[model samples]
Target chain A: MEGVLSGAIGVLAASGIWLVLRPRTFQVIVGLCLLSYAVNLFIFATGRLVLGAPPIMPRGGFIDPTAYADPLPQALVLTAIVISFATTALFLVVLIASRGLTGTDHVDAQEREP
Target chain B: MTPGPEHLIIAPILIPFFAGALMLIYDERQRSAKLAISLGAVMAMLLVGVELLMRSKGSALTGFNDIGFYLLGDRGAPFGIVLVIDRLSAMMLVLTALLALPALIYAAAGWHRQGQHFHSLFQFLLMGLNGAFLTGDLFNLFVFFEVLLAASYGLLLHGGGQLRVRGGLHYIAINLTGSLLFLVGVSMVYAASGTLNMAHLSLMVPMLPEPQRVMLHAGAAIMGLAFLIKAGIWPLSFWLPTAYMAGAAPVAAMFAIMTKVGVYVLLRLALLIFGAGAGASAGFGAEVLIAGGMATVVFGFLGVLASQGLGRMAAHLVLVSSGTVLAATGFVLAGGPVQILAAALFYLLSSTLATSALFLLIEPMGREEGGIAALLALTADAYGLDEREENRQPEVGLAIPGSLTVLGICFAACLIVLAGLPPLSGFIGKLGLLQALVASGSATGPMAWIFVAILILSGFATLTGLVRVGIQTFWASDGAPPRVLALELAPVVGLIGLLVFLTIKADVTLGYMNDTADALLRPSIYAQGVLGAPRAEDASP
Candidate 1:
């Protein structure tokens, strides 16, 4: 479980960082989204791998101690996800607006204008 | 002490949030409704700020529904997402309210003409500003930061001008990048420390292993960069002047407070988390901060020197002020408790006042009669302002009280304050920080002094630029004096009154600043304020 989590996190980080380094605005936005996913997963996995367990215990019987996962990180991840989503939406609109207004998606395009 | 109701902190944040939403349903042209709602929101914020300030001891509000949500410190703790209003935060809220009130009033005068939902956007912006200052949790802090930025995004492009829109895009892009960095940094910190609560992290941080310690510091540096960008520090500060120059005066004034909040957060985190003696190599820390601050100061001054318009110059000054505070932070980091505390407190107060005044002044000075073009032409004709500066934006006569003299005086006073000249809190704050840096035996002592020298020089440059501009507009012989409308003069006068107030009660103000400084240096009060008393024999939370 740790291996899978670490591998996915690594890929996410590498892809996000690579995109972020690009000059395109769309790429940067994509980078941010990827990074956000990696961060969210990283934070969740910090509670340790609990693949078969539900965060909330079943009501029918007293739950096994190791069967339930920590819910705090999940709650936090939920908030982070919502905030990131809003952020991405804002970026998309801004990207479209700027592209329409300035006629460029390349971050350097504005700087290069005489 | 018994926990106060947890809702007090939440009140300041929620009032404007809900009010802003309610504003959207009303007609865009309903000026009266917008004004009343805005007035009510600011008034609520003012009351909450006042309530929080009057208390000597800290209070918290927490609910015990499984996971606790707490608001504690100062007077009473209201339940919900805790809003701890310490002496420092309370004072900031008050200052924010003072600035926002007139800016809002000024916005109302221009709302219809500007063709934006000024009131609704303004309300949400205020909500974000208030929430940013009030939140006890780190994640919530980012939430408020985004809220503020979102509102600013709308407000900046309210007029739909091409230049304004382009400038707004740049501003949004930089801040959005900063926001992502902030998120990454905070989550990394949380993962490393095992707690997201600031108070808990402060305690847990010192015990972390070496590599993790370095990573945490790296996280802090990243977070610092985010705020610094928001604060408009040099290198990352190129977006400020053009962006601000393109905005409506009232919007500019309100946005001025936003940068200060960025510096405020940086200061808060620095003192509370990183500066808690939990990190290795104090020299490295001080050097990094001071150096960044120094570069910021230099660039800001250069920007001021090259600036053509009142708005751009003011934006440059904002950069200088942010840098000044950051530079001063280095000294505060190295200096003894008394010195660090005093300087930090004074810098915060002085910067907030100076920046807000500049914002208020832009409306009157940028108008056609009072506009930078007229001011420049008049100044150039009188003192030979470089005629090569032809690409300047045109200024129109202000819709408000358009007195160039009042505007000149207000702008000059702000310049003086920003430059840390005598008879203003800026001078006192700078003096305190200088005294401390000189006393602290850090290796950066020479560099600190050099930064101080640059600060002084930048102050003079900005002052000269302001005077030159003012002279052209208000004092030039052949220049037609820009007419000052009454509406415009009100904000100018109100800001001046506050400046006078700061001068008159300088000692009391410094005393309060001193207490705030002391509280910052001694993180225990903050720790206790945020986290409930440690259980049993555990020293660290």
Candidate 2:
């Protein structure tokens, strides 16, 4: 499970970086989304990849720490997701604005000569 | 649990927040009301900031060593988000408020009305700046950074044009990437240490084993990269001049302080978590910071010389200021005297104020005629003038308009300050920095000498560039004096006036800055203040 999760994050990040480096604004926007997803998963994995464990403690009991997953990473991941989502939307709007204003979808807002 | 003076620490963040939300309800036509509310909110924040500054300074006077900690939701520190107000944070809050007032006033002239939701976005930007200065949690700092960046994006695109759109696109994309790096760095730190509170992290960082320490260092370096991007260090700062030049005048003026936010965080964290106290990790990135900072200063100087427009010149000056402070921070972290840090703080204050005034002055100065055409004509006039014509009129009094005279004086003051010439705050700041750098005896290594050389060289370059621009704008041009309004002129004059005040009161301000620097260098008080504060419920009888 750890191997799979780490590998998934690595792949996502790699592809995201590739797309983000592309010239098209659309590619950059999509790349940002993928990068954010990879980051979100990476943040989630910080809790040590526990399975079948509650994130909360039972009341009035001597709790074994390993019986529960760390909840802070979960909370952090949620916040990251929301922030990244909003920022991606903002990036898309800016992409469209740039495209309309400059008559190009290139990240530089200029087209290459054929 | 009753409210006390300590509660005022949170007011800086709350005032603008509520004001922003309130202004959102008003439509675009209700400009006057929104303006009034925005102005009121900024004034309130300034008052709160001053109050906090006084309290923090007073605590130092009484030798109490009390750093005000405002725990959210009555929770204890390290477990919940916290706002800690030390002398440094308090001073930053006040500086932000001071800069915001003039920018807000200048924006109200016509810039704010150029786009929708201007007032609300301005307020939100203030909230973010104040929050970032006051927050004690690492994650909370990131949140506030996003808040400010989001608001800044709106403001940058406020007066939408092709230039602004293009510039804003790059700015947003770069900052978005910086934000992602910030998240990754922050999460890695949290994972390694199991804590995100700055004080808690400071404690845990020193005790981490070899592997964890390496991870922590990597995370810190990554985070530093994020800040360096915002602070406009050399290579990372390629987008700054364009983006800033593309924004409306007041927006650019407000951005003068934005770079300082990065410097502030670097100084704060470098001293707090990785100070001499942090075993094995002490002075982790100091060398890199010094090298980068010096290179940035050189780059900024070159940029200043190359820039044709006053707006771009002001943006480059921002980079120069950031570089100087960052380099000085490296000096302090590398075991130089705390007085060097004090000098850097003073430089930070003076340079930020001067650059902001310069930005505000650019629009009014350029209001005479067609922008590029007029500039081209001025250049031709300067270069193509006949020798007999130049010698024709006596070098004495020509009938200069009163408005032009006022603008000229303000422009001269900015020139003097940015160039670090005598009789202004900038010279005093540089003098202090140079003095401290030289006086630090054994610590005056090659890096210190390099920093000193760069500082002096950058100042010279700035002087030449600004003088050329000023001559062309004021003397060579034959256009009518720009119709400067009182509202617009007030902010520029006010900022220049404050710079003058900073010069006259240099000793007192330097004394306060020294004290603030002292507090920063010693992290024990900060750690105790944040972690030792009792929760409200616990404090209650």
Candidate 3:
């Protein structure tokens, strides 16, 4: 499971970097979304890949040290997801605005003469 | 439980947050109400800042050694979020309030009306900056950083022109990538240490085994990259000048402090987590920081010379200021005296104030074409007219208009400060920094001398560039003086006056800064202050 998850993250990040470096604004926005997804997954996986374990302790009971999954990374991933989502929305609006204002979808907001 | 004065640590964040949210309810046409609320919020923040500064100073004087920790939801450390206030954070809070008040006043003059929700966005930006300065959790820091960046995006695109849109696009793209890197670094650190609380992490970091130690260092280095990018170090700062030049005057002025936020975080974390006590991770990225900072200074010097517009020149000066402080931070990390860091802090304050005043002054300085036309007119007046006509015209001496006199004086003051010339805070900052650097016998290697050379050379470059622009704008111009509003003029004068005040109180301010630096170098005290605080259940009646 760890191998598969790490491999998937690597692939997503690789493709995201490629797309982010492309000239088109649409590609760049899409790339950011992909990169954010990879980051979210990476953050989630930081909790050490526990399965069938509670994320929090049951009230007033003897607790085994390793019986529960680490919950902090999960919480962190949630925050990252929300922030990345909002930023992506903002970036898309900016992309459209630049496209309309400058009459181009290039990352520079203008096309090269070539 | 009812809140008390102890809760004032969170007021800097909460006041702006509530004010911004409240302003959202008011209609855009109700500009007066929004303006009043924004001003009131800033004033309240300034009061809170002064109170916090006093309390921190009192703590230092009484030898209490307590770094004020305001635990959120009354939870103890390593679990809940915390807002930690020391002399350094208190000073930063006050500085932000000071900068924000003038910028807010200037924006209210006319720039605030240029776009929708300017007041609310401005308030939110303050909240984010304050939160970033005050937070004790790494994740909270990231959240606040995003908050500021989001508000900045809105503010940057506020008075949208084609240039602003293009500039805003690049700024958003680069920062978004930087945010991703920040997340990656943060999560990596969490994975290795199992704690995200800064004080907790500091404790855990020193005890990590070999494998996790490498991961921690890697995560730290990546995080440092994100900050260095924001701080406008060389190669990563190409987008800064353009983006800053593209914003409205007041917005750009406010941005003069944003880069310092990056420097502030670097100093805090480098000393807290990677200081002399961090075992293998001590002084992790000092060499890279020094080399990069020196390069940034050289880059800024060249850019300042190459820039034709006053706005662009001001933007490059921001880089020069950031580089100098950044290099000084490296020196401190590499076992130099803490006094060097304190001097850099002084320089940071003076440079930020000067650059901000310069940004506010740019719009009133008038356009480049106007200067050219004025030069043409002056040449025509000099030679085109008959000798008798020329002699009859100025025998009464050039009657400098009141506005022109003010602008010229302010321009010259900015020049004196930025160029590290005498009789201003800028020169004092540089002198103190150089003295500390040279006087530190232990760390005065060849690199230190090279940094000193860069500092002096950069100051010379600033003098040349600013003097050239000053001559073109003032000495050669023949156009009618640009219209200056009292609201706009007051802030520039106030900022310059503050610099003058800093110069006069140099000894006192330097004394405070030295104490702040001494505390910063001792992270163990900070860790204990946060981690040793009693839980709500234990403390409450």
Clashes of each: 34, 0, 0
Interface RMSD of 1: 2.4
> Least lDDT summed over 10 consecutive residues: which range in candidate 3 chain B?
B390-399
Clashing pairs in 3: none
Q: For model 2, how does the per-residue alpha-carbon lDDT over B46-143 read when each residue is reduced to its tens digit? A: 99988888878765354644588899987889899999998999889989989999998888766665567888999999999999999999999999
lDDT of 1 by residue, B222-254 (tens): 777788888877778888888887777778887
What is candidate 1's lDDT per residue for A23-102, written digit by digit as tens?
88888888878988887887677566777778877678666868788776787778778877886887687677667666
lDDT of 2 at B40: 94
True contacts kept of each: 0.27, 0.71, 0.87
User: Tens-digit lDDT track for model 3 on B1-541?
Assistant: 6777889999999999999999999988788899899999999999999999888876535464448889888787889999999888898899999899889888876667566799999999999999999999899999999999999999998766677788999999999999999999999999888888999998897899999999998888888889998999998999999999988888999999999999999999988998989888898888987898899999999999999989899999999999999999998988889989999999999999999999999977874355323423433332332322432342122223587789889999999999999999999999999999889865648888888889999999999999999999898999777656677778899999999999999998998889888888989888988998787678877
True-structure lDDT of candidate 3? 0.88
**Better candidate by TM-score, 1 or 2:** 2
**Cα deviation of B534, candidate 1, in Å:** 11
Off by over 4 Å in 1: A1-28, A57-67, A102-114, B1-6, B57-81, B276-284, B335-337, B369-402, B439-444, B477-479, B533-541
On lDDT, the stronger of 1 and 3 is 3
